[model samples]
Target: MDRYEGFREFVHGRQQALMRSAYLLTGDASQAEDLLQTVLMRTARHWHRLAGDGNPEAYVRRALINEHVSWRRRLRRRPETPTAHPPDRGRDRGDESLHRLALQEALMRLTPRQRAVLVLRYYEDRSVEETAALLGCSAGTVKSQTSHALGRLRVLAPELADLLNAVDPQEVPR
Candidate 1:
């Protein structure tokens, strides 16, 4: 296959997983698609370097994470105005959808790093060490971020307390 064909195959193989991670990170399907596109474009520019490495996927993931962090930093510096009217609640139906919306809202209250850490560690089911490596931070930072993120979620959505409390105790580690 030509180099372009090879690169296209590599990106296509990893696109679904990348989109899943992006969705969890952004909590918005549209934003996640945009983030994935941005990450893929940036990765394509460095495809030669990445292809030489044993794991091009890891490089792309790191680039996505870095871009997300940078984007959050820029957003933090800007003053955001609240919407005059709340989003339409008509679209939200059933208990499951409400719970998901609550979870998304709680997640939005966290810092970008904390959100990333939680998504990597819990949603992606990565070990703390692995999450730390992906984030280029210490394992302790991952633990702390997870703790803080969970705390924030609990505070922001007390209803979630029941959901967490309902977990089977035997399934959770001490």
Candidate 2:
């Protein structure tokens, strides 16, 4: 466990999770693949620095978010030119028929910041404070954004309202 072997094991165990989160953040297969690739490369390079943090998974997740935010910022600045051909198809799209896909699509319709907050708070099961820390925002902002996101989600995907009923209001700090 002292050598690169430990890093290899960590990657093997968490790659799926990393990829899923990346996909959720990006809402595009190609971007998610690229996101995971860059994240892994940076994680490997800074493994020693992060391993000592005792919460490397959180560190890596924060890294993913930072990268996503950075990408969003860059995308905002860059001009998009139309392509002659469409992107390549056939990738691990997961079970597309699952009800989960509906939720994912609805999420993609949200603003990037709202989507990030929703994913961090709900999908990733992070606390408001934790999400705020990761996204570099205040707890109040997280709560308000979460409320707005949930409201939008309810309107965008009414079927998911049942799932919202199952979540105790107290669980998400007001």
Candidate 3:
């Protein structure tokens, strides 16, 4: 009973953070929900073993990330979001919502690893060392990946690049 109670508390405390990270990784709301559910289920199976650990959250997070990568590799294809032409440059209505959608679409176009790097480094506002640790890579790899992700974003969506430049880094939502 105590173990179950503790697990419940852990879920209540961490569900939002896990969901946010899952959404960033999957890029689709439904898929994100599924991903979180799967991770939670798997974690529950090892709850007894993990619960005694000082930082079970880290272990669960590592599982979440590894599972996400495994799923992508098994599928052998990127997510298949329907693409639509962006609004004409000449007729810019300057709609913030539209810009946000465009930015999201651009993000979805990125490879999973690139998207993960951006989400951890920018959206989550984790330090390079932290991001590298989470991704199981060196700090130098994180730096290079961040640089390349930014460049890819620029090329994939110039308008989004402008939007990114216009917003304060702090204003960027997690």
Best by lDDT: 2
Question: Can you tell me which runs of candidate 3 are displaced by over 4 Å?
Answer: 1-5, 77-94, 166-174
Per-model CA lDDT versus the true structure = 0.80, 0.82, 0.77
Per-residue alpha-carbon lDDT of candidate 2 for residues 60-130, written as tens digits (9 for 90 to 100): 88888888888888988997898999877445556544447668778888888888898888788888899
lDDT string, candidate 3, 21-48, tens digits: 8887886778888998898888888787
Cand. 2 TM to true fold: 0.77
Tens digit of per-residue lDDT, candidate 1, span 50-135 = 78787888777777788888878888899678999977656568889889889888888888898898788777888888988998
Taking every candidate in turn, the Cα RMSD to the unseen true structure, in Å, is: 2.9, 4.0, 6.0
Which model is ahead, 2 or 3, in terms of lDDT?
A: 2
Best by TM-score: 1
Q: Which stretches of candidate 2 lie over 4 Å from their true place?
A: 1-5, 83-101, 164-166, 170-174
TM-scores of the candidates are 0.85, 0.77, 0.78
lDDT of 3: 0.77
In model 1, state the lDDT of residue 77: 98
